[model samples]
Target: MTELRIILFLIGVAVLGAIYYFGTRKKVDIEDELDFSEGEEDIVSVRPNDLPRKKSGLTVDEAHQAHEAENVQTQKDKIVTLFLHARDGQQFDWHLIQSAAEQVGLEFGQDNLYYRFKGFGNNKELIFMVANMLKPGIFQPDMRTTGLVLIMTLPGIMPALDMWDTMFPVGERIAEILGGKLTDENHHIFSRQRIASMREEMREFDHKHSIQ
Candidate 1:
């Protein structure tokens, strides 16, 4: 009887050991599966080449060429200017200038300067602008200036020649009224030769624009 009981106890111990080993292996397999699932999720969430980047436009050389072309066009469109200066050791009186500008059909408007317009009312187009030679170039009450600048942009609302025709007479009249002398842009005496040259230039400008 004693031998049989000992054999039965040994059998029970072997069965318990098998159950424990299988349960531990199954738990390790489940944990390994969970770890593998988490790794798969991380890989799926990662995206290659997802960062934003600047879109390519012009190349460096092309951009520089474009800038140079714009500058050239701006130079071509630059204003053509003439100056009117008071006689030596003299300055122009503000009241006289106002009256002279008005007589020449210049109206005080934008930039506190004077402008000569082409038409009447809303249809009016700017022919030229006149400003004080002083810094900031605004005409104010009781202002006295040594000179003035008359300016017009090329290819204006009117043909360049016609614009010059209107502008020159207006400058002449204003100078005559104010006892001033009309000069070139550099404030040098405006010679008859220079006047003829300017007229030719204006004609050339008008012709070029007409073809365009």
Candidate 2:
């Protein structure tokens, strides 16, 4: 009877060990599966960059090139400038020119009923200005020893073609008032034919860029 009781106790011990081992293993397997599932979820969220490139319409390199091209074109467009020269290699009289410019600004402002013209920069040596009637910063005035060069530009975009009507006329008027000469970038005398050609070129640009 004693031998039989010892055998029963040994059997119970072996049964409990087997149960503990299997339960622990099952728990470990469940925890591992949960971790794997969470890892897959994380991968899905973070792999958006790996999505089909065609679905985004352009690859990263192509997008970057397009942006660069746009910048180049804007620079080119801004370079289409108009100029006015003071007579006989002289610099403009600041007070007289400023008064004439202000008058022109006021007249244009009244006609537009919305846009104003204001000078830019704090340099007492120069009279830099912009079309307040249109968008701010669309025009910039460069005062050199020879004359003032007006570049049609904004911070990052091209100047509007419609602004040419106002800009060129205002420039011519100011030059006339100041006894200055209206000249091209090369200091060539401005003539009817030259202005007509400029207008045609601007129209072409406006058409191409769908500006008007």
Each model's backbone clash number: 0, 3
lDDT of each: 0.60, 0.41
Report the CA-based lDDT of candidate 1 relative to the real structure: 0.60
- Residue 174 lDDT in candidate 1: 87
TM-score of each candidate?
0.64, 0.45
Candidate 1 to native Cα RMSD, angstroms: 39.3
Candidate 1 to truth, TM: 0.64
Best candidate according to TM-score: 1
The residue pairs that clash in candidate 2, if any, are: 115-133, 116-132, 116-133
List model 1 lDDT by residue over 137-167, tens digit each: 5578898877777877665678888889999
